[model samples]
Target chain A: MVDVVGSASSLHYAITGRPNCSLSAAGTCCVFLSIATITLIVAFGFFLAGAWVVLPFAGAELGALFWSLRYVCLHAGDYERLTIDHDKVLVEHHTTKQDVRFELNGYWARVILDCQPNGYCRRLALRSHGKEIEFGRFLSSEERLNVGRLLKSRLGGYLS
Target chain B: MATTIPIQDVHNEHHADNHPDHHPTGWMRWVMSTNHKDIGTLYLWFSFGMFLFAGALAMLIRAELFQPGLQFFQPNVFNQLTTMHGLIMIFGAIMPAFVGFANWQIPLMIGAPDMAFPRLNNWSFWLLPMAGLLLIGAFFVPGGAMAGGWTMYPPLFIQGGPSYDMTIFAIHIMGISSIMGSINIITTILNMRAPGMTLMKMPMFVWTWLITAFLLISAMPVLASAVTMLLMDRHFGTSFFNAAGGGDPVMYQHIFWFFGHPEVYIMILPAFGILSTIIPTFSRKPLFGYRSMVYATVVLASLAFIVWAHHMFTVGMPIASQLFFMYATMLIAVPTGVKVFNWTATMWKGSISFETPMLFAIAVVCLFTIGGFSGLVLAIVPVDIQLQDTYYVVAHFHYVLFSGAAMSIMGGIYYWLPKWTGHMYDERLGKIHFWLTAIAFNVTFFPMHFLGLAGMPRRIPDYALQFANFNMIVSLGAFVLGASQLLFLYTVIKCIRSGAVAGNRPWEGAETLEWTLPSPPPYHSFETAPVIK
Candidate 1:
């Protein structure tokens, strides 16, 4: 079997890709999306309100009723799932899936942690051959350690 | 070949091996605590204090409104009471309670040792009490506390009493505290996770908090700037919002709502997290649509920024602007609906029980829906035109804040009291508190809907004779509701002092890692991390 711990390091690199998608790029995308989406939603609320007011009393009530119905429709079902194997971590939801895998042999990998003193958990990062992958992006330190050990034990021999 | 690895040694290597004894003692401990749990406790106690303070103000307002025609205080003082009461409760009471929960639980649930920036946590928390002092101190100032509503819209705000500066300064400080707190939360959540804990496997509470933090960081600064401009207009003769200074007052509303709307979600999303955690545990089921809940929170946060203008529908923006805000505002219900349905589905066919926490969770679901329905009503331009600034609007938000947000917080406290105190709460007392709060809350706020429909405006000291009876009833309920909170405090204190000792997992149904540890968890938990199956 492939060494799981070593694979985790390689997997980290594959997940984050290269210098192409920098942290700044992701931050910019997040900012752009936030401003664009908020502006659109506020504009739409005004439109419906105006239409309701211009209409007669019954029309206004109908508008209110319709708004409620639409509200329910737009807000109601959406979630994602993640799983880990020896060579890769899999994130899947609905119709989408991303598999990140790594090769442990002849590659050096290091674990990086983000520690918080006030009640937040520390995060783990695996870096190998100039590429970095973060696991436990959603877990606390204890959970990360548990997962980390399993991978470490499995892949220790393959990684330098 | 045999190899022995000390579990503690391995655990220490994996986590931050900070020695708790090295921390300062006595009053300095509180001032310098970087421990999330310690900070969390500080936040909780502070919020409780603020709640009582605001409640006192509310009682005073109710006493004045008890018989109408102004009995207890003058109109100006009443306005101050109303305004300060709203500001204190929203900023000081409810929001801090949620943050308190976040600080305490996020690290434990995620299995991390602490928050990312512990020192910053201390700074964020200390700012609250100081801000509170300044705000309450405003009453002692020469002119008395501000009388404009909590929104603190300008023009009226600029011309307010001397205490206006104190209130504004306090607000600025509070806003700063919130932004820093949000930043800490986001960085910790984003950067910290143990091995194998993928984002999708994270708890709903963590996911919701992550989104709420994002909302706080992005929107709170805008509010700070808006208020800063208001301050400048008042003191420095700048006119960002003053019409005579070539600035439009409407511009202030736009900027304020942009921040204000998301701020509402920031207050409530954690409640959503609390409800999500409680409902699943009580139902004896894992949260249904776990990933969906995360998505829903993100979608809701995204939508919150857009729908803010709906608050200004009556302010006469162009038709296109109204349509956009209304539609966008309406769209938010979609993601929110997903969360509600997921909770209900989590309960469907599961071994559900009506423990006090679950009861509160259930009440939150039902009552908050009523609030949401009213929110939809407000989203419609014509309906809002009729209801805007009326008691109808009053009823709408009280449902959301009091019943929705506050109720969930209470439930969370009750659910975790045993865990925090190492003792089970008096169940009978808990039930009484729940029933009293539920009944009193409904009695207080439900009629405001009818009062609103009758066209009684809010924030007024006196009303016409026609609106007298409902107001009287509402005032009575308000007294009862205010009185009921004492029971909660008593219950918490009693449990902490001398309730029956609870073993690990006081609630047999609890599934989280927190329940796995002994009640009143050790100074250090999971010295040897427990493996998740």
Candidate 2:
């Protein structure tokens, strides 16, 4: 009974995995766009209230600069994930049991992202305990080679 | 899933083997206790004893003023009663009660097993009783007890008899106690919260205490310096507040009010926190705008330091300075207003019930607002010139202190009595005590405002016949109010000894990790830390 229920959930995960990347990206973009739009509206409202065209224009320009500065400071990370489970595409950042769980599916896939040199990384990259994997290696050219070599050695047998 | 870490569980197992047997019982346990809770109980009982003693002195003052002809005590004795009453109540009674509350509650609230420095807590509490003994003992000295009032404003204080010396000594001891107590409180609160209980997450009672302790550490030394100068002038022939020595009496007033103004808030802000806690519990609501309430307390504490000179406006400070102080004093109302609004908003649209604790909490809200409004009127430069040193000032502070701090202390006692005693108090006796005291308090103080507006100066043994009838009524009400406290004393004791057994969570509307433990909690509560979700 437990095996049947587990396999059914795994099937559901495999079907929903790959498309989640676009959903997350769209959500982030919407939030950023809304905040930027609000800043523009408030700046214009202030200008109209003051009834000084030049003064309000200068103020709005300053406001826009501040808005962009904060936006970059908050969310400079630019990486995306492509996950698979149950010998099929699973929910991105999601997984199921018994499908070579630690196997990295995406490779040399222009994973643009920010990386803090001294930042903490998660232990056991996907819980197979083969070795510690540096997950954000896609952020740099040299890191891509190091990560790809490690992944090939660990997951080559599991891949199709 | 929310993780449950029973930190107390670990502590109990670790400390169980180390627990002492053959622990000493009886009076020696009290005298030699290094435990925070035991010392806290000592401080509380000592404060209550002083409260009754000072209340007696107040009755004497009222009795002498009853018929306006120096009927009961002589003029000198009347002055002595007035002076000692204020001194005893401010330093001996109210301040000690607050320190007692801090000692008892702060450790339990913060989930610390005990005060950071238990020995220092014991020493500080012990000094209080010693100081009280010396001060009270001064009545039997070569001359009567000091008659220079609590401020002990120089010239008069220096000229008084040997009791003056005794009073100064007692003040020094009390100052040491307060400074030590404040330091201990500050250290404990800063150093001892459970993990995940960040500064913002701390209860308001703890926050107000943090500010009050800071006020004490900063201003208390200045007060000690001022009193030292007074002591020198009295004994060493140095003139700090003497005109002959080229020192000004007004300088004494400046130093006194610098300590006195924040001292008033120190007495009352804890009451504000207590009311904040009790009102929301009874109303069945999360305290509205918790962050704003925190900010408002900080603002009020910062403003308290700057507005000291408002107390000395009539002492002929520069007109500009007077105006500055006046406006600054009035600005206090803004932060104070935010607190009141937050409390009222917390109770809005909630399932409100009037328990004994709630009744006192509500009375505190209404009566303290009246006091705050009168304080606003007194803050006006022109009006203060008229009202300063009058019975109006007297009426103003009684509302603030008695109905404000004292009411909340009673409420806190009732609110936590079940947890402390493992039994519930008789509700009927508590309600009767509340109503009688509230009505009698207003009756005693309200007429003083009219008397002051009619130009009656305070601290006088005699008054004109025109103010006679109201004075008589106020005096009668004073006796009744004094008598009403017996009900509270009786109810507290009866509950402590034998009342209905209470469960772990006595109040259905209560929230707080403290409620998640057994009643009268074990000798050690929460041996293991409880995880905050």
Candidate 3:
């Protein structure tokens, strides 16, 4: 599905694939915090019962859980946007940490679908004049194919 | 998910469509991969390596007992071998092997894109090798590995040297790895199922894994707590198990078996799932009692928690408590019996094929039942009082673990190897391996029952002259069993290298979602969610 963000003079397609998190951010935090707190209480109980060595192991386990949850959530914000008109296509890619933009001549743009021998979609990239930007990393293979096809058809007439 | 091969012309349309996977090559591909398939491969291979290592330790234990007297190793060294053997086989071999299966099959079966948290999946697996190294590293320490058996009971456990600390630390690491793995699996199974694939409709392997994951989450923490206390008593002067320090030694047994009993169920529950999957497939029938099988699984897991005291029957408890644990432990046999009966009913008079996997499945039913009966024998307090810590207990668990968990794992491997490698192993050789394994396995552990009945105690490096004959037979069978495993290693490697090509559904009656995908599957399986009908 395409989410249009610009006027007719300059059309834009922004395809964002967030982590499939069913819970809201706050709900996610609450769930994890509950787990951590319960684990801590159990460990603390053991400590009070004279098994204090369990505390560090519990901390490490909670720490791993916290870090992994954070990593998944952070990557949920990743996005890829393609802004194009009659002249050029500008591609902006947003990872969890940084945003990168690649500018290419719209007339020279080509959409490449790296597919498997069995026709499974692998990767989708936009290439032009030795400059390329690959996106759809978080998309399903079918979604990637649709995105590839959309770009190909929209830019077919302008191919240099 | 609909399977469609991309048009070759479409591929030719672009210049940069050169490789299917953009991940790194060589060693870094394994270490850096967040892909489920890659991580699964790493886990399987690592577990196989540990299996051989642990199996070697078993061979040594047998070699020492070949003629009743310690021929090669000292008592302490022998104790270390037994201790490490149990720890490695349970933690390093069976558990990780099943987790590998979960990693490889769960996402494919559920039609999710991948595990819920792929990076954490990677982290969970890598921790295993480190934990294994620590356990192994204890051998090189100044005092050698801890000789206090894998159970790590206090007093004796607390008296060990520096290596005991290493062992305890290793247990903590492995426990954390298990807990993390269970969390990842639990989240993935709960939230990542395809649109139409409800829980009941999931494959038996997935169902069993879901239950087993919960068991892990519930059980491993107690083990972690127990070991943590062991560590504290050893170093921190805290006597949680020390009576002199106002702690009770038997309390450690209570805590350890609280985890240990469920731990046994944890190992076998997935095997139950594997057997359920295999039996129906070979019988050319839908599972006869699918819902009952799931119900039996849940009942069995719940029952596991209450039966912990059964193992301590001989430890001097009140008659009421003994009676309670005895009856509770014996009651486990009922649900387990339901499972066995269900498998038998599933295969009763159907158009059955005796393929290698089915052979292992059938053997597991017969042999594991024998193990179950022995467990029932041990469950009776009067009998257990006579048989505790005897060769009888050894025979009982080996039957359950070797013939149950280990055999089912081998069956699963055979059933899935074609799919995993995109090639069929040599059928003739496969059957040969199964026969050798089945025969040799029984010959190895079955005699221990008689030995136990005749009053042979377990975990000792030497035996009296009266028990010499059975030990000799068991040791000989152990040698044969150890050698037969090499045949399995050879079969797997040969299949991977140059076996015949396998189609998407290698087995004729297989009808799981995994069978709908191509053999060897793509690196990114289920890129789109598959709709289950």
Name the candidate that leads on TM-score: 3
Where model 2 places Cα greater than 4 Å from the true spot, the runs are A1-160, B1-17, B20-24
Docking class for candidate 1: incorrect
Clashes of each: 53, 6, 2
lDDT per residue as tens, model 3, B1-533: 21222222122233353444455679988998888888888888988999999999999999999886669999999999999999999999999999999999888888877888788789889999999999889989987898998999879999999889888888878887898888788667766777677778988889999889877765666788788788778888887899999988887887788789989988999899899989999999988888988998989988987889888876788989988888998899888988999999999988999999999999999999999999999998888889999999999999999999999999999999999999999889889999999989888998999999999888899989999988888989998989999999999999999889999998998888889888898776766576677
Task: List pairs with backbone clashes in candidate 2.
Answer: A17-A90, A17-A91, B7-B528, B7-B529, B8-B527, B8-B528
User: Per-residue lDDT tens digits of candidate 1, residues B255-309?
Assistant: 7887899989998999999999999889999999998888889889888877888
Model 2 chain B lowest lDDT segment of ten: B7-16
Off by over 4 Å in 3: A1-160, B1-19
Off by over 4 Å in 1: A1-160, B1-25, B526-533
A1-160, model 2: which lDDT tens digit per residue? 0011122233322211111011123543553354345434533443353312223333433353344334333332322242334342211222222122223333221221222254312111221222222233122223333333333343323221
- Judge the docking of candidate 3 as incorrect, acceptable, medium or high: incorrect
What is the alpha-carbon lDDT for the whole of candidate 3? 0.82
Per-prediction TM-score of chain B? Answer: 0.95, 0.95, 0.96
| lDDT leader | 3
Looking at model 1, residue B90 earns an lDDT score of 89
Q: Supply candidate 3's per-residue lDDT for B151.
A: 92
Q: Which candidate has the top score in DockQ? A: 3
